[model samples]
Target chain A: MNWFLKGTLTATLLTMGGVGAMAAPGVTEDKIVLGAVDPLTGPPSLLGKAHSLALKVWQEDVNARGGINGRKVEIVFEDDGYVPARSLQSLKKMVEVDDIFALIGTSGSSQLAAMMPLIDELGIPALNNMAVNSHHFNPPLETLFVVGPTYCQELAAGMTYLVEELGLKDEKYAIAFQDDEFGDDVRCGYLAGVEKYGLDNVLELEFKRGQKDFSAEMLKARAAGVTVLVSGGVVAEHSTLLKEAAKNRMDITFLGAHSAHLTPVQALAGSAGDGYYAADYVPALTSLQVPGVARFMDLANKYLSESEMDSLNRYALSGYAGAMIFEHVMTECGEDLTRACVIEKMEGLDGFETDGLLGPVTYGEGVRHAPTGIMVLQSNAEDKTFSIVSERMEVE
Target chain B: MDYFILLTVSGIAIGVIYGLIGMGYALIFKATSVVNFAHGEIMMLISYMAFSIASSWTLPFWGLLLVCVFISAIVGLVIERVFIRPMLGQDVFSTVMVTIGLAVMIRAVVVLIWGADPLLLPTDIGDSGVEFGMVFLYTSQLYAIGLLAFCVLGMWVFLRFSRMGVAMRATAARETTALLMGINVTHVYAIAWAIAAVIAGISGVLLGTIYGLGPDLWTQGLRAFPAVILGGLDSVFGAAISGILIGVLENLSEGYIGQGLKEISGFLVILVVLMIRPYGLFGTPEIERV
Candidate 1:
């Protein structure tokens, strides 16, 4: 009985030592675990699924290459279902239960906002590429690293190109936007373009989100003689607007934010999506001309199944780019990777390139968001693909 | 003038869809005195079913519509039996709550099967619009208007002349009394649901063709609610007319006022109309003695 008691004590001490040697939270000698919260079950699952697939591909690639500092990386995903409260709860669960070292795949603007307090409290090094809302960075959190420009900046840049470079300055401009923060951001860009180009701002309209019918809005645009329309709709609304314009026989040039750079938009809009300009921060899915996109497609085909491959869109590229940036930061931190170390390295990142997937990412002290350059893309309705139509326009 | 004409035409097109769905709501409520909160989900589910069938087979528009209507009727019957029939003796609120739960479940099941991505529904009618001088109309829009008219006319004829329709009306007026008079109230309830589902299915498919099919398509049912209230909750024909009136009013409001008033215009009308006539334009006023 004495020998058994002594042995049990020794075993317990050894277990304590083993647990202590695991280094950081969610970090073991052989593995580093990360958390992702996204709308995985609702209408926004398209974005979340693509994001997860990209992360999965990146994880596979990193593990194959011995991971960061010889530790395999893993991601645990929680579905927020696009609800802000759910996003907060999912983040809480991931932090408390999963013990994630870093966070990625923060959902929409409101969702990310909901998780911000928890992220700050936990000191989680988070990379947000999905939503680059300005509020998230106005008083930047020390550990939050934002990639990509805000919709305002993106659309503004795209409009600049349309007016100055594409020679749409003479056309009557109109804005049909959703009445929300996202729409307001897009409208800011539209207003900027109108002011800079001294163009005719014929009409500015707002519609409710998830509105199916846009016939009245299109008719209103037609009445205003809008020759160049800036569509501030996200995914489905963009297609609906185009369809309405087509039905109205309104000969107009349409422009959209980064969300328009999707295969689904082109597919849904059918012939109406032809020649529509979409401003994007990342190279398009079909922009295989870029080395980064070519490599991504190769990796995607290799790692993802046939259906998963079909699901690849701009979101996938952005997610992969984000994962690549995280990997860079982690690689730079070497074997001494703590959440603080990752954040420190991320803040010091300069001209980090995704091999042309995105503009050179540069972040420094006091800067949370790296205003990456924007590219304008045009959809070919026949093939349901978008091709880069302009050089990357650097936004200040 | 062209803009007005365009707005009016477009409003009528959307209004017809709203009316069709509203009619479904009215029919069910009239027969069972219990609102199927799943009316929108039924519409969305049927549309998705139609989408799946359309994707897998090469069927003309008419053939696809027929198939969807038939399938929707069976779904309605099943829903009535499995969910509604069991709760016949329960409180009306409980039955309504069940339908609300069923709505969420149907939405989940749809997302599970088709995923969250919105898909373009292929149809026989192409994207080209008919040019009526200054006014333009999509082929789908024209079809929607025609279908709404056809359904409303058929419903009117059925209720006025058919045996089952009269039985349903009797059952709706007084369930126990209808039962005493040798009418099977359960059968009438099932038939009402089936017909309502068929109407909703037709509207859903039309809306799908016009707007594309997505999980959020169920919200269209909610949008048609104002139509139902304005037309009288239990008056199918009144709901049909109110749906169009609300649609036109919404469009005109958006066209002129233009500050996102289109969505609220219908509800505003409902409020004003209800304030003046609580029973709606065509609804039967109920009387009680305490």
Candidate 2:
């Protein structure tokens, strides 16, 4: 070979080796920095604040334990204010400026949908426990790991329990849902249950997203002789639906998704809020009997203020669980942490337990969605709390 | 048949609340020639004020309603003096923009104070309400309908006979002429704002009781806008009747169609009405819209 050709080969090999050995961004020998995008301001801050607080508790606890595998975990949060456009902006800032190794919180459903393209392009490991949509993992991004069941899966499991276990197989069912993507996911589950059990579905009602009144919807439900109702409402809609049904003096069994598992639902529905069901993957905050919940409560009490403790909800439990999963993957990666290593460890999560805080997380090979099993919870209006009413149920 | 009766009654109940909000909008426009874009936020602020009052001190519904009237009156007067009063001689468009800015501020302040969680107004009436045959209405809802009637009658009587009412009508007609005729045009504007604030307070407290109070409760103001435009923006009585008409139409459409049509049903009717009348159902071409 010519002298110039030999030197060119040596230089090219050195450049390839240097590119291969470069350390991951947002990671140092003594620290691992992650990013969180949430609706930290505005009205939806209720969810974001609680999630951020729980993650704070996790961070303090991890560092107090001499750090996870000898690297202190640091998280930088950007408020998306529950807007889709703001979510993409927040994610971009976190990637370019914060240089985050992973994302721990992905705002609301539609908000996260806005950030997916960038998430894929950046190949950043994202642990999503706040909002789980089917589209989030159907095509499957390489580094995004979802830690909970989609609204479809939760509602379907809830319907199954209502039909098979609750002995309402012959009862007529109906659904009052919104007219958007989350609502469509809910309808998918309700229809799935109808098709699987051959149950009679009398009416399928759709309403606007922020609609408050349901008098007409309830009257139509009454006209259809609906005995079982599935609600696809987000927050106040569930309470308002219950209130409207009570006003119409309808004897109906209502079931909803995880969003219904909130104290304000009972508070707004007054006495009419009693005895409704919510399907969720995480145990309720009031479920102190669970070992994981007990541990989380202890840490939260030890770390959070009185008002912050009061703000703890199902979202907090899920956030802590996400932190646990992230810590597990990070530890498994040992001192040689990288985005690809975390992705591999997360994908191989098989029945990893959160001690009853969440259902067993089992993301089989090539699957990004770790659909932990869903459980049914019944509301008690008097106390404004929920108790587990059904065993863990899996979505098919 | 029973279902229709129930839906109609419910629609009218909700419509009465909207009419109350629309009355505020109509009252401000009749007196100031500028739409108070912050009218719904005015209701929300007062309702949250009532919530705070009730939560802090255990007061009966009547007692709470009375306190809210006083507080809302002060709020309206202050808002008129501080915000709207400054833009008095400016173009109507600038005054409307000021109201819009006031609206954004009031909404943000409400969320900041009350937080974003939905709250139930504590009440002695409870949720079962009064049931007449197949129809059921909350005590607050029944009060909502009664209050609308009382407001319309009181407004009609006051505007027809009272000296202040004559002054208000003159000011609404021509501020410069009213000023020249020693009518105290600014005082008329203040009185108009105060009365509108009282009506909004009543509606706010009642609606909060029925629907459960939240930060976005101000959106109901926008919902009542069609009532204002559909009835004649300058005609308070027309706004009330149009509110009822729109509410009933929304409920009936939702009942019959069942595909989220209720949200746009009122707007659709308003579109048809505007296309036909050009200046709303009751608005006059040159003057005397009231």
Candidate 3:
């Protein structure tokens, strides 16, 4: 027999033998360690750093509250640098070396996708709050639970709001998106909305990722007389699109994915930044209206420095909310806190609350993607804030 | 037709910025025969510097530009002295590799200071634009075009007329012969780096105003490469004009052809140009007698 086959059989035997005798890998009598992988260094660190900080805030807050079921909570964070291969490596290291009980911060969609196989093989109960796609939940992994809606869901809901609430069903609706998976998701939502509303879809344009110039796209949109635009840009692209629209003096209503609900986008767009809508699953950091957010802000102020406070955003809120759900599930799993028990509990979650930080998280039989409320927020450039303009625009 | 005009005008406006950056690459390669892989990162660093300067001092546009020019000159001199000078006698590929290393270090340092978030350069210059009939150009965009013209004219006069510029051209033509002819070869290389850095610095601030400064801004350095190769790897004049050409081609392709074509249009032109004239349009061909 080959050495590989021999090692595989031995490893299988060792795993089967250990599974019956050992408690969950990361659980101890005094502490429960969770693992996270995020882009802590590169350009995507804008999202990753803020996100990890939010998770830090949750760690502090939870530990201060005596942790989950009298055991202190410890989180092990690994920097993936936003690379998919690095993400897989980080997850493996966390599972093997760190011996983490669960993963709470699964980074970007593609990065998470890269790490999904190891997660499945190891049966790691991962709570993903960062990036959600239909692929993450459909034929859902038994142990992976996702909070918040996909970009498609959020965009579709935004379309519903624009069509049903604002009565813009007659306007020339269009989507200018990056030519990638994320952009494809946004287009899916836009097309879904177009089909649902029976609206005139005048244009659907795709531009390359990292594309700064939108003059051509805007000209095309303008020539087509597009009035309503669904922007699939993340940050700078959104601002550039708005600026281009403003430069042409085109009175187009702009809607974007949650990535647009950022101060930089507005700041970059300058005077042209105002009056765009972003569909988000979580409240903005500036949103004090939500009870959970107000409390999180209070904790953030107490725990984080002013510079750290600057990193607070919807990404942070979602991260904190995901931590809250994880805490709830683990606490309910009792003192033993086995991986199976935690997975079972997560699968049975119903109406788990994070104090309006999210709509409500509920996972069911053969369904791991939780239903959450979506909000359409309008950007007020002067204030660098988003005001919620809709109610329960949740797409289950 | 209006759409075509709009795309073309915007294309030229953006093309000038690309040319400005491409000039930095061509200038370095022209003097040293070493391609600066770090050109983009250097632009990003200078842009962040401009952002910091504009934020703290509240300098007017021209005031900020002047400060950037000074800082970039110093930065270029420092980089050339510290990094490039040591590898002077080494293989050109080694020097290029050092630049790639410098690029990585500069990128890391920028992230360390700026913390990875996209920052808008704190200036009111980006606030407005001027429109003539069917097309509009941001004030910064206009500055970019004017600056490129100034650079082209200045480079033309300097290389043709000025003693220092003539020395640089001589050094570029034949380093050993220029050294034999009593040219300060090291000084020429240093001057080239400083001049290129100043160009990059100005381009950064202009682009920062146009697109906002981000970690990803270094990408403009790479995006401008097609302009450089299409112009000629070693031709500053070619780099400038091809930048305009490539920018128009990309815009027109996207405006007329489709979405994905714009991204590839410059590369397509470069492939064709390289196939036909490897030295590029208006690039002086180099021949070696075996």
Candidate 4:
């Protein structure tokens, strides 16, 4: 048994060495390997799985189109489970072991922050569509290009639409946010909305993550006579807050960050989720009116399994768009494909379109983030879907 | 005044759930002198089990409760026999550590079986609530409070009259003395685990109904820890009352003080209560022979 094990290890090492000798890092003559780190196993898997599925669909489609410069694209996904330390470790393994040329599907803001130094150290060109934090772009790295607006930008734009377009500036506004960096971003937008519109700031409440009950918070909101509520929660918390409000019979206009644009939110929130506004960077998943969404759905149905097709949401659209952008950079690099060449193309990218999936993306010169605009969506409880209620509005 | 009443009522409803879970901890600690750290995981597993069952068939609330209780009791007995029975004569700390390990294993297994999605437990009562003037109560909240009362009454009767219950009490008092008195200490331990598991199962189902079930549901067990400490780790009745007290205190603190005071209010009460009465409100003072 010991001899057999030793022989297997020796053979594996020989194979790895042979592969290393035959190719440049993450790029063989016929294959260009890419890597992704996402929260694939824990609570955040809802987003991560869709992210991976989208990448898979893109990979299949790109390969079917005769690959990028005759090199079949291969993507390796690592599950970070939404932990920052794990995200760092996953990126290190992807760089040193898998020798991935570029990275897509970065984890949450903090997780990506943990992996930022490693990404810079390795000089790996990466695209981030999931988490768009201000810190990532404030002092930009050489190779990381971010798409999508930050939560602050999304919320601020949504609030702007509510106050300016909907004419609810005089209403008593309040914010219920989680006590974390994500919550802080939401608060930044809420403050911006309040300052811009001169709305009555009635109440501001911060809750711990994973807090199941919001009875007291709802009571306080009621006590303050809050007419407009900014829900600063994601996923289950979004549904939970709405549920509590429904129970209290509080009749208030509700708005949520982009994360609340999920079908699960509407399903979980049931009747209460109806008519709630959600701010997002991308077009609605069920928005067949959008040409990009129609194309994505057609490709997704052809490539993804039935369950995978059903699981397709806004994250899938973002992930597909991110992958599409990366594909374009790889295509532009052509036969002289290298990390430096890819980065060069990415930095010069401007007016990049996703065929209406998102607003035109542009990153050039010192700019690291693009598509800093948001569209407001309203939930339709009957169909468990969101409809675009506002055109793309940029946030300063 | 309406806000206060609403907050207090809701707090009491949640406090009843805390008490229900705390009783499971106290029951095991009383019998075996070891904390069942996996009590919350047991609650979580049973709740998930209930979720699965409810998904397959539409059982009335009472039928669902009975099914969960039966399945949970069996799981409890099996766990005790497999994990706790072998460590019976060893240091009590070892048994406690075993429970902690069991907790981690249960959490992993649960996540494996049921993916980490927050699922709503479908029931006949769907977001229906009754309003008495300004005070409104969701049916699930009212059910939780009523069920806690029923369980407490049932526990009192069982402890006061049943032969097995008396045997459990005897075993808890002194293991060797109870052995000499012809009480099967091992049987008592198994019974205690089964009863505790039933309590946890019921509490978990009610909680899942109210707040939706997710992987984080197990954390509520840890949240109930303060209630057991304040009520007296060995006092079943005390745990129930303290659970309500903690719940009310937490809500009142959050309602009045605002911010995120609700999460810490229970611990603050536990700290003060422990400082004043080291043995807890109903726990017997231990007179150790030096």
Candidate 5:
């Protein structure tokens, strides 16, 4: 085993030396491959698997319509299992082994941060995905594009509505965030929004991912008499928070991050989600009024089970929308199918709309951020469904 | 102050689950002297089975729990026969490795079957908060605590009075002497695993209700390890008590110190406990031949 490992390592190094002079290790004619490394088998696998499946569906749909202008778009997906080291390894394999046109729909900030140097060196036209970190926006790369609103924009929209529109400018609020990059971005957004609006009455608490109990955190919020609670964590943590608050009979309203808008929340939180709210970039799955979303629901029914269809989760819709964006970008590139042409067309697209999955994605000078619209969803216990209580509002 | 109580209750609820599983670990170690590293995986697998039987087949919770326990017991027997039985005379390291491998295999099989997506397992115990003076408690939390208490009493009584339990104790006391006295050590080992599996099933189901079913459930095995060690690997009651202690301690640390200290604090307590009492708080001090 030792001898074999050594020989393989030597071969890999020799191959790298030979291939390093090329544009990338694995670009080929008649096919443009992309890599998607995300957690598909670990704790956060829910998000990764959903994103992958959405990408799959989109790619199939595009292929059926003549394959990205006659050049097939294939994605060589790698499961990073939500770790930085694993993500780096997968990114290397994707760039070296199954080289493709560009990468899209990656998950997690830390995972993306690990691949930043490679992305910069390769000058790859990478999408920021649904990661929502501020680093993706700061000192922006010429080849990178953010197809969704940044965490700051999303949080600003939520807080702006609460402060200016809802007449809750002076309302007592508490922020509970995960202790990670994503959480920091959320806090930054909230802080910026509060200052911009000159709003007062806010407190902050933080929790780590995979930490189940949140009683002490909730107690501090309770002591402060917080009316609104914002959390930057996943479904499990939110559910535990809701259950604990319900136990304490606290009248505080819960606000979840975009990622926590999931199917499991309803069951996990149970009655604790009676009046919970979340800020969403896309229309709620419960909204059948939108044409594109109606079509999406119909397609989901045909392809997936009702149980499998977490129609309310903005992530799934975002996943589906991401696939659509790739298709549109490929079409704009025409028959040339080169990475440069695709990037040129993508950066040139102004006010590109997606029938309400998002408002418009326009990449231009001093305007790399896209889709600043957010809607607030309130959980209704009587029907066991979340209803959009506020209309879509634009950020700035 | 109010928040502290809330955190303590929530922590205790989760601690009860750890205590129950830790009890299973301690019980198995006492009788067979083999650490069942796969206990959490077994529990998760049995919970999935219960979901299939209860929700899919429409069995009631009570009926599902009973059927799940029976199936888990059989699975425990099969594991011992196939894995542990082969390493009867082997060193302790070999047995431990086999169980670790078995843990990996169980998690892999589960992922393959379940497709690595988180599954929702809604408990039928009514989702209303019970008011207790100033504090509120989820029905599931109360249900979990009640179940833990029942299991602790049941285990205590069984070990004190039951013939099979007494035989298991005898085997643990002196394997060669018990064999010479006509006690079937093999049966004792199988029973130990069986009992452990039942307790694990309860923990799995409760945890599923609290936190949805996912492939990451195996991490609980690692988290439960500290509790088992702290309570003494061979002391069943000690394991249960320490599980709660660790759980409460973790929450308190996170609550007071802040900055995501629950995970670190739990391990810190384990380290401190080990340094002070090498054999664990309640672990039987072994008298080595050397």
Candidate 6:
């Protein structure tokens, strides 16, 4: 018994020694390589360029600080043009050919859906660039990491604010959503909100992707006496609908998902978008205290063109947050980091705060989703700026 | 009562613009058995051109509108000379397929140059709400509807009496026979495209006033397709009338249904009409030789 106990102790020490042994270059010894794919020249290219810029800013800042514990971090990006097939091809090349340590940011829900299986099979950690579907955080896989608020949560928050906070409970509400899974997720949340409030006042409408004319949809809303409009669509459709509605003089209140409240929509809608309300996950750029934003403003002024400086959209913040998390995880992993160690360290993170742009980021055994919820913004049409209507709320 | 009138009048106004644009489709199809899928893009481009000429050159609306129409006609001639001209002797199916490709290319070029952001065309015609007793009308709506009527009448006169228009009709009826009779069939083809482009330019200016100018405006071409198809692919007058009909029907359906059937009601109408008429309301009856 004494001999066996001695032998067991000796074996344990050898195993520990083996793990500590550094024969080859450690992951954080000289450089850490990461890959990202974005749509640089597609319909969503505006969002893509913003995300890539955010990634660059984060990487530059990290390198300036001596990078993840005295090592440089390198980011390689490929333009996917928002095509799912191309996104999958680029992701495969990033993993198999380039052999990136991990994928930091990817764009689009459909593009992510196409690459999800391969992402799981490769066991590579991916911080989603734009996939905000709730299922991304649910049944959390070891290889997947989501950094944004889910559409379900965002929509629910919008609904709650309209019903509980704004006293729009008795108002006749109508929903116009894109006819797809992303749209379905929003409709599900909307319906769930109506049931929870028991308002007995709801209208639902769906438009196919790329549909322009919404006269029929607007007419139906007018007929139903819909006073509150909830839209889950992109900018082009949103702007078109708003203009059409104004032409008919509906005078309805609008509540839009994040995708609908872009700069293009704001510009097109102009004065008609005065009272428009939208829920966002990231803090506004106009806020004073966000740590990195001020720095970003300085860098943007110094580096980015004047035209690009003012046009920065939501993707810019999300992209920067993604890079911030990547830096945090890599730094925490230390010099002798492996894929497993990186995952372990990232999973253990709690109260992960950024320059106050995002709420506290938390990921662990039971909790995988990180976002705190909606930051309600109302358009000040006269000023052409969004004003914070409600403090950031954690709806979920 | 207020909402109903508002919805009805606005619907009719938009439908008028659609009808005017739909007339281009009918005109091109009437002259050549080809459906111009790029019609909306052409209209969108002309509107952009008009905006550029007016804003950049500081020309008045009347001058800009006339120049825009002339430039659109030239563009139509060039498109015929380059893309459609080469496919004259090819199968009609292949020729029709080229327009689809042309539509995509136009949209890409537009986005590349202007980006995907929407641009509003500022028109001072009707800036305020004009109350007509109990109903209210925007000056812009009045302009759109009035312009639509004028374009419709112009198309009627051109097709009904002009010598060149008569030659176009002869070529449309029988390209082979017209060619044999030394009717300058090529000129007729070019003329048809030019006329179609003018209609598209007028519609574009009208629509830009109502919906703003954007790259995605090509979808309007698809939306207006059902109107032309239902009206009669070969009848210019029918296409114009059906455009207004479809627009009004869509709004009325939405106002009454409250479930969003207005969006697809035009397509539904096309489906039902196709099943019943097969050749459309004014389309030439197919005489199949078994």
lDDT of 6 by residue, B59-133 (tens): 655666788889999999999999999998898899889998998888888777766566666555423557676
Expressed as tens digits, the lDDT of each residue in A1-396 for candidate 3 is: 336634764585487576576667788888999999988997888788888998999899888998888888899999999899999989878866788999999999989889887788778999889889878888788888898898898999999999988899999998989888999999999999999989999988898889888888888889989999999988899999999999988999999999999888988898898999999888888779889999999999999999999987788998999988888889888888998998999888888889988987888889889859898999999888889988867693
By lDDT rank, best first, the candidates go 1, 3, 2, 4, 6, 5
Task: Write the number of the candidate with greater lDDT, choosing between 3 and 4.
Answer: 3
Clash pairs, model 1 backbone = none
Tens-place lDDT per residue, model 4, B166-212, is: 99988888989999999999999999999999999999889888788
Q: Judged by DockQ cut-offs, is candidate 2 incorrect, acceptable, medium or high?
A: medium
lDDT of 1 by residue, B191-287 (tens): 9999999998999899888889899999999999999999999999999999999899999999988888998999999899999999899998988
lDDT of 2 by residue, B132-237 (tens): 9888888888888988999999999988899999898888888889999998888899999999999889889998888988888999999999999999888899
Per-residue CA lDDT of candidate 1, range A1-396, in tens?
Answer: 235534754565477686445466788889999999878899988888888888889999999888889999999999999999999999878866787899978998999999898788668899998888998988999988899999999999999889778888899999989999999999999998888879899999999988988888888888888899998997999998898888777899999998898888888898899999999899888888899888888989899999999777888889999999999989998897888789889999899999898899999998999988998999999998888888999995
**Which window of 10 residues has the lowest lDDT sum in candidate 5 chain A?**
A19-28
Measured against the true two-chain complex, the DockQ scores of the candidates, in the order shown, are: 0.84, 0.71, 0.77, 0.60, 0.44, 0.32
Candidate 6 regions with alpha-carbon error over 4 angstroms: A1-29, A248-251, B1-7, B48-63, B122-138, B258-260, B286-290
Ranking by DockQ: 1, 3, 2, 4, 5, 6
In model 5, pairs of residues that clash are A33-A100, A219-B3, A247-B136
Q: Each prediction's interface RMSD?
A: 0.8, 1.1, 1.0, 1.2, 2.7, 3.0
Q: lDDT (0-100) at residue B48 of candidate 3?
A: 98
Docking class of 6: acceptable
Q: What are the lDDT scores of the predictions, listed in order?
A: 0.90, 0.89, 0.89, 0.88, 0.75, 0.76
Report the candidate with higher TM-score, 5 versus 6: 6
- Per-residue alpha-carbon lDDT of model 4 for A102-203, expressed as tens digits? 898798899999989878866789899998898888898998889999898888998998988889988999999999999999999999889887889989
lDDT of 5 at A127: 76
- Report residue B213 deviation for candidate 3 (angstroms): 0.7
